[model samples]
Target: MKAVRTVAMLALCVLNADVPLNAADAAAVFPDGAKLELLWSDGEFTEGVASSPQGDIYFSDIAGKTPGRILKFDPKTKTTTVHCADSKKSNGLTFDLQGRLIACCGAAGGIQSVCEVLDSGELKPLVSEFEGKRLNAPNDLDIHPRGWIYFSDPRYGGPEPIEIDHLSVYRFDPRTGDVVRVTRDITKPNGVALSPDASTLYVAETDNGFPEVPGAGSGGGKVHMTLNAFPVDRHGNLGERRILKDFGKETGVDGLTVDSEGRIFAAVRAESRFGIGVYDSTGRELAFLKTPEVPTNCGFGRGDDGSTLYITAGKSLYRIPTESRGWFLTGQTVP
Candidate 1:
């Protein structure tokens, strides 16, 4: 009997040793069947993933309360690096038509500011104030091919430490250096994305009423929740705001991306059954792609013949092949 037990224990040890350590299983917040391939994993929570022309992925690490940085992932080599530190609490990122990196930066007095990364990797502030008032906390941003940038200014991270005013979405024109407030109704607007044709802009309505999550947050709790979609105009102005959908108490929406087919993909919050929620062009829930972790954002990675879908959840980055590819590299003239 003792010998049999000993042999069984040895066999179990051997099996455990042979099995490869997978962080996906450890960090998964829900069930995932999309054949998740781990691109990178970190202890810091990641958000706002964007792909460059060369197919490299860039994301922000919002883990540290004081210090935040942007990380880059190289698909070919399967390696990740700290692309930039001291991002001034930058949360969202995207590349403009000219291939310049656009960031939504936050600081005590620099709330909802727009900045650009030069070729030499220098941060230059573009828009800091709108209408002579400090912009709120600019969370996530998306750029249209027509040199117009639309960013969400939720009070997620801002100075003055007040949450009384309304959260808004703003548009910045690269040519005229003009800034316009597109919408002022959203509560805690986050993660912004534009349609492939640049006619529509989507923003995540994370209206967790200030202070945040009661005991979960210091004073910020009550999430006044909803999602919104706005029409995009040529002069960097928004036409009309529309309700996309509403979320439950436990779940909210963040960082969004649109495919070449104009399908919107949003990262679902805590109570979401699926980490990533897929929506049709008409604001319908088409399908939900279960990710390994609680996805904060997603991006389309250009492959040789097709493209790959990259999702950034908790501490890991996941990828899966998609039937329809994104148009970031197809030279499609965007509005």
Candidate 2:
């Protein structure tokens, strides 16, 4: 019996050695060699992360078919709680200057809307339909310094429209609940973020429907990947479009965010290598943070004093220490 027990222990140790490291584990490899320790991973793919003023992380669970939910993660306790369930398949999320939770909901037709949960737990829909025409599902969003809210509405999920042109970007007036169409040129705008100065708006164009490339198959045929930079106005009017970066291999860019220094961190699934594509202010790929799960979105928030990179990947949330500060700022004022 003792010999059998010893053999069992040896087998267990060997199995543990073969297990792969998680996201939290990978995060610890940052500057101080600190990897992310899983806060709570129930095998549900958590996508699109946002932070509250109090330093809690909110993420969307988009893995399940029906019953999707938005969850909140408290860094202090390392506990995750369900914030809101039966969400409209909420994908990307952010908070406005007023600290109201803003989410991009899909499957509600070409009608992109913004909802803010009031203190009474009531969700107030700010903008639902755009230009009398429904918006093509809002994918991701970011807020500007001047209180204007910008979002991406790409109709890539549902069946292709047999009629309308398809997909556009929108800006919402938080004060008056008005929505405006800023641009309608990108083939599929997936991730959207603003520069530090709020002068440039970056949108990631990823090809969702395409042929499978033989030998070099990342997921599809050829990823017509590109990032666009747009000039914006205080009133949320975008102008002057220019190509920032183009990754022609179809490693489809998904959700993204910018740091305070104007660097873009985009989540890209490239040939089974799911990670982030780091771009400098001048639109150059600086470095890549590889991950085990396919990351959907990421954002910057302060933890342990300096800024930390919080990433949302398949069924888990992770964070790593960074040299820069948080992108989400307070009363310091930025224009």
Candidate 3:
């Protein structure tokens, strides 16, 4: 009976989804006129969207002054449930090769920096402290096909003191639990994604915590938004960085994903032009899919041929149909 009710609820939610996106005419990656359907919206701010092994979706609700929580959605039941009461205010999340949920947690309140969500729903610190100091609030994270976990530690609108001097990106080896600083080149790095072939690394540079530039939007001289790509060295270090696209002062890129074909899907939070922008490997803007609000992050749903995308924007979570499967879904997650 509970399952039945859940299914019914899901049906009703779909039928009444806020900001419905019609994808019947959807074609390729950009899928012009694709519908961006609102799926859930009960949180203060949602992030950390990911598809689980069970083909379910999970997201985070960092309620600022309140205790952070993690929410999971079971597509089979078409229901949403609370997976964790205290989520350490995580921002970006993704599952590892070992099938464990890894998160760049503790964005707002004081908690673990980066942790692994255990089967018991407990939080296990993966790389919380660097050199004896708690890491700056980790904003986003991604795993390499070789099992190395790479994350960005950027302080974006949190009251926590900046423990780490520079806003940088880091890599952690799960097997040895060793961490290496990837780069601090970007003034503010918010999103980190590996290419489908795992040889290229892409980072989204956004000034979420800096003073905005005059023409660079509303803040002081803080936000220099752009998409950058770097070559992955043979020894696992990032090579020279290349500018993919620069948004000047317009909103900056937040979290981003890549499709099986190495195309980049970026969740752009540029207020006036907020939405997801799809670009090819060379950083050419191939297509633009607009979301109703400022999007934070995105992840494709389950199955090897999954074509559904789950997006986290502001206080709501939305979904839209996609024409291609995500990198992981294509069975090419790692080297």
Candidate 4:
């Protein structure tokens, strides 16, 4: 047992290196003097960070599968508190046009899928099944300006039986009340977001699986981790899979968001290069924001004119000033 544990530790250290880049990484995407400041540290695994309509920040604490909960941060107090004791272990989160908290809560229990948490503390089930069968797990999500919620359903580490034939990306249209499979080209999709113009869709192709049982998250170089982009038609359907960024042996990202100028901000999990990477639409590294731990997700703060970027990693939440606003935070409201 001791020998096995030693090997696993060594493997983890070996696999986590910087993502292979070209010879030309000369300029910085972020400001050269940029600094990341710790905002809070109160969870075992913090993730699913998002901003509310009133300017408050919301996130989830997975607590290593004991029981996940939702948390809220008030800018006025600069403090964090438990928003919902039962978050259903939701990972990635976003808000709808109605300012309602839309959560992808199907990952942990395999029971409740995507849900909308009202201000009254009521959890309304949104999408749980497709073609009369239960879902695998809904991981991350993003809301289109047209009221459609696009989410990635991938089994990371859980005891739930895989009900779906293949892990894919899905969009739930509130208007038609139907869930559309956007794309199945990915092995294990993790993060899902959109461009500012809403003309393109972004999905982080982490196609990696982490077993929820013992020895979970141990090194297994079997999964391919990459980021992909798909063109969006007028109807919100995907066009084709275009590989944007491939991490090869390095760990891919968990969540990603865009800025108003179409710049991509990815929460990279590669331990050796753990932090946030800012890239242009063409996949050119513009800047890199270093965090103290492996970042899982990020959000632009409206309080600072969208200049502040919030991050969720390990057991803490961090914030850093940026030059761009969130992709969808123009105040015109999402469509």
Candidate 5:
């Protein structure tokens, strides 16, 4: 595991400069000198990154308490393997529509569920408790073309004992194993996406006041980094909630991906602007990709590396070659 080729060059020296886009929508969303390529910086943080229906690249390397790893990056043998070395602490990695691998096992004591990564690698607990109370860690997920699995349970700092009192956005129905709690008006529901004709459901509330359950109380004060747009009917249920981008105090959006013209590729953890924003399913701001470190998730890469753009910053795994192209429920053509 040693493949790092720097050259973000301050992310192409802030390409699209200050992002008000007009140079042909900023070169049709980053193209002329797009660089950002770290590839693999070892990991202890790198969140979920998906992309595999032959174009390998599966991220997540949490390792806060030891059990977390799922690193398989091989854009044709630039090598970096160890796919699932006990990833109970996994954090979002999608691929359904039958290609399997749908995880979000948010750590704490581990196995905090919304899993299904089994081709013998283990972990197949699809919806780990909702009424019997157990989840509150399932970080990110999105896979609904009818197979519905939208997750995000938000706990963020775990030492354990949070039994899901509220902090939600879930919907797991793997055919009728049922587990719905769509969104309790999110105050802390990290990344999730599903709009490329799946209607719209882009939640990413990322409240960094972090303290919802450590001693039990305190994450109540200044909450709302915002980026919400829920309105998905046809039985997956969820309406009324349109805020779509509002990072008032800074540090919003942890992970989300939607391009296929329904644009939105946010990871933006705003330290003063720390990379990857690209919005526009009405959240405007169409292009900004500066990640030297601070991003947490982003994915797009399938047949022919789709349009390439796989990032999971800080303990690294970055890529950038976009002109936009990612909206997958498995293998393209979802209009």
Candidate 6:
């Protein structure tokens, strides 16, 4: 694998790092003179960035003709290596409480489910079909503290026929091996994230007017792009959703991560302002860090590098030092 290094000149605009302005909150999320450093830029479509327990960065490269690859970046060695060569088009990845790597691996002609990627690079399928029918495509996911896996299922474009009617979010219980449809209210859900305390579930509704149909040029009707907050119950159920931020006619968020304070760091794809948008849990914009390309996903490192934020955009991976640390349910246990 090849790696590239470039300094990303950032346009920083930070208001409040946290809700209440303390001595620490007074400091901007991006430290003074902070900039994005390009780590690698040789992917087809980079997505699903997650920091391992060892502080190593892992992201997916969704290929066009070949199977997706999960690449790992070591901050100490400063090298990029292939973690999984045949990822089955894995999109979103996270580590469970037991320090196991869980991934949403289902794209066009892909695995079509959320599975656990073992140390031997083998996939252990957790859930493939929701009911009796196969899922459209597992896109992104976040695990709850209680071991429930919440993921998004939406088909953007593919030659295969759509099995499920609605593009929705589903939650799978690994203990019981049961899958439950969390909600199908969104037009097309792209990213799914849980709050630090597991009280709120943030879902990014990025509808880009489905793929090309035989008769119609662009099939799926109206496009609704927005970031929503859904209240999550103790039983892993979702309540009425509240539209947090509406992008109107522009492309919305792709993937997002929450900090320890529950602040959302979203990969906004708005053509007018493409970058990472940091917002409070109540939908208030807190900061914005512009990227060289349209970002797909973002995650924060752990341990000594906990303040560094890793971003995946276009075909490149970028990182910047931030004042905030990522919130992980599993603590800092290494697998």
Candidate closest to the true structure, highest lDDT: 6
- TM-score, every prediction: 0.80, 0.80, 0.86, 0.86, 0.33, 0.90
Q: What does candidate 3's lDDT look like per residue over 204-303, in tens digits?
A: 9887546332222324555578899989976679999999999887877889998777888889877666777777888776666667667889988878
lDDT of 5 at 284: 79
What local lDDT score does residue 81 receive in model 2, on the 0 to 100 scale?
A: 71
lDDT against true structure, model 4 = 0.75
User: Clash totals for all models, in order?
Assistant: 14, 15, 12, 5, 0, 0
Tens digit per residue, CA lDDT, model 6, 1-335: 56544424454444323334333432557787676888888889999998888788889999989888888898887788888889988999988877888888876768788989888787888888977878877999998878888999888866777767677899888989889988867878889888888889999998888753333223456678999999998888999999999999899999999999899999999988888888888887767777888999999999999999999999988888998999987643212
Q: What is the C-alpha lDDT of each candidate?
A: 0.68, 0.67, 0.75, 0.75, 0.80, 0.84
Q: In terms of TM-score, how similar is model 2 to the real structure?
A: 0.80
After TM-score superposition, the amount by which residue 143's alpha carbon in candidate 1 deviates from its true location, in angstroms, is 1.3
Q: How far is 145's C-alpha from truth in model 6 (Å)? A: 0.7
Per-residue lDDT tens digits for candidate 1, residues 1-335, read 01101011100010122224343421231233335677666537777788887777888777656557677777776677777766767778888877777888765444347888665555788898777777666788887777677888766544454432556777788778888777766656788888877777888877766644222222356655566778876665777778887776766787888777787777877563646666776666655565656788888876562357777888767776555566573444444
TM-score winner between 4 and 5, please give it: 4
Better of 2 and 4 by TM-score: 4
RMSD in angstroms between candidate 2 and the native structure over all alpha carbons: 8.7
Off by over 4 Å in 2: 1-34, 108-112, 119-122, 159-164, 210-223, 303-306, 329-335
Error of 5 at 307 (Å): 13
What's the C-alpha lDDT at position 294 in model 4? 86
- What tens digits encode model 4's per-residue C-alpha lDDT throughout 179-275? 8888866777889889988888889988554533222231244667888889998788999898888988778888989977788889988756877
Candidate 1 TM-score, true structure as reference: 0.80
**How big is the positional error of residue 228 in model 1, measured in Å on the Cα after superposition?**
2.3
RMSD score of candidate 5 (Å): 17.9
Cα lDDT of model 2 overall? Answer: 0.67
For candidate 2, write residues 1-335 as lDDT tens digits: 01101011100010112325443432322343444444455537677788887787888886445646677776666667777755566788888887888888765332245667554434566776776755556778988887877887665455423223455677787778777777766666778898888888998887664322222122344346778888877666888888877777656678888877677888877664557767676676655676657778888765553377777877777676665565774634455
Worst 10 residues of 2 by lDDT: 1-10
TM-score top scorer: 6
Q: Single out the weakest 10-residue window by summed lDDT for candidate 3.
A: 7-16
Candidate 4 Cα deviation (angstroms), residue 288:
1.2
